[model samples]
Target: MINGISYYPEGRKYTYFLKSEEYKQILDRLEINYENIRLYFSHSISFESKNILEIYLRKCVLDDTLDLFNFFEPILQECFEPETNQYKFEQIVDLVIIEKASNI
Candidate 1:
């Protein structure tokens, strides 16, 4: 849970859609509480290939909006370690989270 909020990308398939636009655009679409969504660079990525790294999110909840920064933060800090390739680029795919508004 991000910032004590149960938020995660709704489905793995939708994640492919989140990377289509700029980071801001994705956040806007998700309507995630940016104020609450913290950014971290401790995330991890495994170098499966010269330009590929596997990513993981521990317990993020699925909400209407999702921040790549959130998913990427942990990887940037404490996950991926071993890498042999010196040249590699990551192309992040888009991710979407479907959330329903609470009744007032």
Candidate 2:
């Protein structure tokens, strides 16, 4: 019954919300051994507007070259683009990972 809530007061960062039971259910459904399984979660925020997104990429990656933009364009489009321009300001990612048992 693990629960977490993160608030980004300035809205500059991504906020993540997760429940342990839901993750456990997924592991159970997949028949993944959970005896010593470990889980990790992380998230980030991105802009949807191509112009703003390009600016952001440049700041973060230190490169605004066309090759870089093209490399990340498709993935960003699918993950960050919003239905409406008004709602395209930000995107929050919810990342989850399962760590293997030490014994294994």
Candidate 3:
């Protein structure tokens, strides 16, 4: 749960295709050209004005990339910490959560 709200992204079944563009702008902030992430709406409570930018890890990265974990480690670490992310807060998304899964 983030900010006292839990929109179960782990359940997966409840997440649907998000056609709204309100949150798209912030999405680019999550997926960078150098990271091993294929950004998608794994789960989001956009209807309630809460969005979680879910990114999956992969191998390949374009340009002079910092692998998957290396690049996002700082960002993820910041999220895990108690400090508030001013940049994320400014966007439509309240938090960016990461989960490692073998079975989808």
Candidate 4:
């Protein structure tokens, strides 16, 4: 298993989780033979409001090139705006892969 913390701009953070089935599917799609795979991630965004998250995402896209902006614009549009005092959180993404052994 792999575990680590991810730090984002404006001090935003999130925890991530990836299941074995998901990893298996990824490997299958890539035509890779893996003996095992695991992943984990952590971040801090528990105290952020939806607006803050939106702004953060926007900043990420805006500060970068068009490719980055296009990549995140859709996500920003799909994100729900939180209530006046509500908070929004995010999760992390981690991945690990173990290759199958070959016969000697």
In order of appearance, the predictions have TM-scores of: 0.22, 0.29, 0.21, 0.28
Please list the residue runs of candidate 2 whose C-alpha ends up more than 4 Å from where it truly belongs after superposition: 1-49, 85-104
Compute the lDDT for candidate 3: 0.33
Rank order by TM-score, top first? 2, 4, 1, 3
Name the best candidate (by lDDT). 2
Residue range with the least summed lDDT across 10 consecutive positions in model 4: 1-10
lDDT of 3 by residue, 16-104 (tens): 54433434444445442222233433222221222233232221122233344454445444444234332131123334333443333
Cα lDDT of model 2 by residue, 57-94, tens digit = 55534433435456555445545535443213233333
Better of 2 and 3 by lDDT: 2
Between which residue pairs do clashes occur in model 4? 13-43, 13-44, 14-43, 14-44, 15-92, 16-92
- Report model 1's TM-score to 2 decimal places: 0.22
Least accurate stretch of 10 residues (summed lDDT) in model 3? 42-51
Give the Å shift of residue 21 in candidate 1: 41
Better of 3 and 4 by TM-score: 4
Ranking by lDDT: 2, 4, 1, 3
The lDDT per prediction is 0.38, 0.45, 0.33, 0.43
Q: Report the C-alpha lDDT of model 1 over 39-61, residue by residue, as the tens digit.
A: 33433344543233322333233
Per-residue lDDT of model 4, residues 9-104, tens digit only:
322233234566787787777777666533343322323454555465555334433343254444433333444333333443444555763531
Cα RMSD of predicted structure 1: 13.6
